[model samples]
Target: MDTNTLMRTLDGTLTCTTLYGHKYRSAITGQDRMPMALEGLTRGKSLWIDSLVHFTCPLTPQQETQHLSRTPVPGSVCLHTPEETVTLHERGADVSFSEHDVPEDSFLSYRPRLLMAVTNITITANEWQHTEEWQLDLEEI
Candidate 1:
């Protein structure tokens, strides 16, 4: 699992183990190719590899949502990646809603039935956030 799917422990330390795809899949696509093993601090040094039985690993996606540091409310939308772009779609009235009737991002554009009378909207960028990974290596720190 990547950092996006990883959860940190109480002391701001991350615990993870390499998965060979037996009990739980390693990567998101289920292809186990982790370059490093579990990390731990013992005595005073940082340890990389640990016994398989002693390693801390990420849980499956389903299991993760349950115990997430920010647990998702039932029926809420969950974006797995920061780069993931989501478009607005109005689910039917039959859509199961939890504490909210509509998703936060979709609320402004949401229509009760299906369609709306909105004509136009202007898009503006207020801030320039971090760039993608491929652009990083090309720039000098």
Candidate 2:
């Protein structure tokens, strides 16, 4: 797996726009297209998306102290703002296959290869309030 440090800074409440794509093929038919959707998040939203979407919010001050002393698991990070929690986990293997090589037997059987490079992120109101932009770095740790 490729290793790189990522930095994300959240100075204030921010919104992010994302895009998605799909494909289909048949002997008599061809591929199709679907429109993308707009997913919303606040200062403290954390999420993971595969076929479906999974979200996690930040722990409360008490919960933070209890759960997040050093490193955090996937569920422990919480988003404290008014926005919905959202996370995106990209499977590089699933999306890496060639269109022609995809099996024709099952439409739903294809599971995209995803790489969990950065698994967890925790955001604080103070961090968002003081910073203008959020940054994340992935370094050898």
- Give me the candidate number with maximum TM-score: 2
Per-model TM against the reference: 0.13, 0.15
**Candidate 1 per-residue lDDT over residues 1-141, each given as its tens digit:** 552356678999986654443221111111123322213412223212211221212323222222222212233323322234223222432222232233232321111111112122222222344221110011001
Superposition error at 95 for model 1 (Å): 16
Off by over 4 Å in 2: 1-52, 65-78, 83-141
Q: lDDT at 111 for candidate 2?
A: 24
Give per-residue CA lDDT, model 2, range 24-109, as digits (tens): 11111112232112145332333332322222323332221222112232332323333443222223212111222222221111
Tell me the TM-score of model 1. 0.13
**Positional deviation of 119 in candidate 2, in angstroms?**
26
- After the best TM-score superposition of candidate 2, give how far the Cα of residue 125 lies from its true spot, in angstroms: 52
